[model samples]
Target: MPRLPYLSGVAAATAVVALLAAAPPPSGEVTVSRPRVVAHFDFAQGQTPENIALEPDGSADLTFSAARQIAHVTKQGHTRIRATLPAEANPRTPVVGDDIVLGIARAHDGTLYVTYATGTRKTGVWRVAPGGAPRQIAQLPSNGLPNAIGLDERRGVLYVADSVLGTVWSVPQQGGTPTEWAKDTALDPVPGSEGGFGVGANGLKVHDGAVWVSNSDRGTLLRIPVRRNGSAGPIETRATGLGGIDDFAFTGRGDTVLAAMFLDNELALVRPDGTHTVVLTQEDGLSNPTSVAVRHRTVYVTSGAFFTMRDPNLLLADLGERHDR
Candidate 1:
């Protein structure tokens, strides 16, 4: 498992108190209401789900970051191992104890793309076919730490975010050398931030003729224009101060987004106007949400519980009627 410096008893208590104080009041009307839990993981499964992908049948394909495996959770709540990383694929590096699988994207043809890293020197993006071994698609730079992946199916390109390098890379769908697609100051860590976990550009998604990405340390969301010639155009900021934004998904509405705030231990509903509201929080059983996936009116969130007091869980919420408010 990825380890971090431990805090003393007093320091830990102080951190908890500080977090509680920073949280918004439990009772307050917001544009999007809190969602209810639809499923959770039991103690038997020692998996820390990091990213989520939806199957055609409504099942969820999750990346087990710590477990070094991929798991499938059916709509009926049954869990099964879809694939496991080989030991060689997750060798230990200087920065982390072992390579942890982070980003995951499913193609229309049922292929799964996963990104993993132990340290800058050993990071890679892989393509996994059903019932087949993982194939290394692209090897990132020595100082690049790939975090999230998004596929542009129409153009046969895969976009990946490099957290440490603060850049987005575009690779051929069939696997080859990656080229820098875009890089900007907005993708860098926020000024005055303590720089916890060394994360910056963390999430990537393709939506509405553009590619969307989130800067975890900077707490910013950006959209990169995708040109018709399969190249990237200018980058634009969509939102800021989103409280440690992570992997997010569109709500199928006008610029509405469901974002996981890792540091805040909450889920935020962000609007196109750059305003946001806390829709779900730790009080609602979110330990440290890392990603959110939406399918129609149903929402699924994966809490890694990376540095929290609770265990990891896969939660579901229904946006059926509450989303309108």
Candidate 2:
């Protein structure tokens, strides 16, 4: 999804929230993280970290969206470019007209997969093998905006969320022809910035036995079960009141979610019962937090600074801190 500058969308978002003001009741008590900045980015160099895939060794693979590149960052904050994507020839993209990379996922064998959206001939999913060049594995719709990607390692398949077209596509982990895995009005963008590119289904994750998706425009999280026949089952609205949600990751604590709300500059702790709490915010060095990844008791958050256009960074927080309420 082409992002709106924080300046342009804040007032509109505030007005919308004021008119539809309601919060979900908290499910129960839970401990949250206190975030601290670990690494910073320079926007002029196109170093915005859009999504993250953590390695077994604690390093991170990131999609530098708008940079058209995939990069890696060490646990100690050292960063380097892995591969730069091909330039879009006819760069007329929908929404913000950016021909950039979006989501990324790392395979168990260290093979890295990323999504590119140019709204042109180059829009597709690309694979970057270990010590190899990036190659296109699946061709998505040029008119659609493919955002976050999720890997089902057990099934050897990948699921992509199309924010513009409101569809979730399925492709082989090794790259093949894409298939429309699921379609519903529930995934369509009906609110927020950009008329044609409201960008509904922005983030995706294949957790447990279902494909979990975040609807940015509708302010809800959805879960679609994968049936025994490998087809999409029923769609369930898992959470609500998350107006500007972008990408999210599940913590080890049994179905709990840590989500990034880029539009609101907030990190939310969403529980299994669809209730959530604002655990971190702009005060925690967040400038439009985009993605979240969890490893043990540590949480990784990527802030692209798309709205602030300043101080794009990686923030870390330690979990397991309990607060009774």
Winning model by lDDT: 2
Q: Give model 1 RMSD, 1 decimal.
A: 4.3
Cα lDDT tens digits, model 2, 267-286, are: 88888888777778789898
Cα lDDT of all candidates, in order?
A: 0.75, 0.84
Candidate 2 stretches greater than 4 Å from native: 5-29, 191-197, 321-325
> Which 10-residue window of candidate 1 scores lowest in summed lDDT?
1-10
TM-score of 2: 0.92
Clashes per prediction?
Answer: 0, 1
lDDT of 1 by residue, 1-325 (tens): 1223242232244332123233543332223444555557642344777899999888999888867688899877788888876554436543344667878999998999988776544467888898888878888875666778898888888999887787899989999989999888777654434644566788888999999999876678999989888778888989987756889988877578989886667888777877677778888878778898888878888887766736677788876433322
Record all residue pairs in model 2 with backbone atoms less than 3 Å apart, i.e. clashing. 6-307
* TM-score between candidate 1 and the true structure: 0.85
> What lDDT is reached at residue 304 by model 1?
78
TM-scores of all candidate predictions against the true structure: 0.85, 0.92
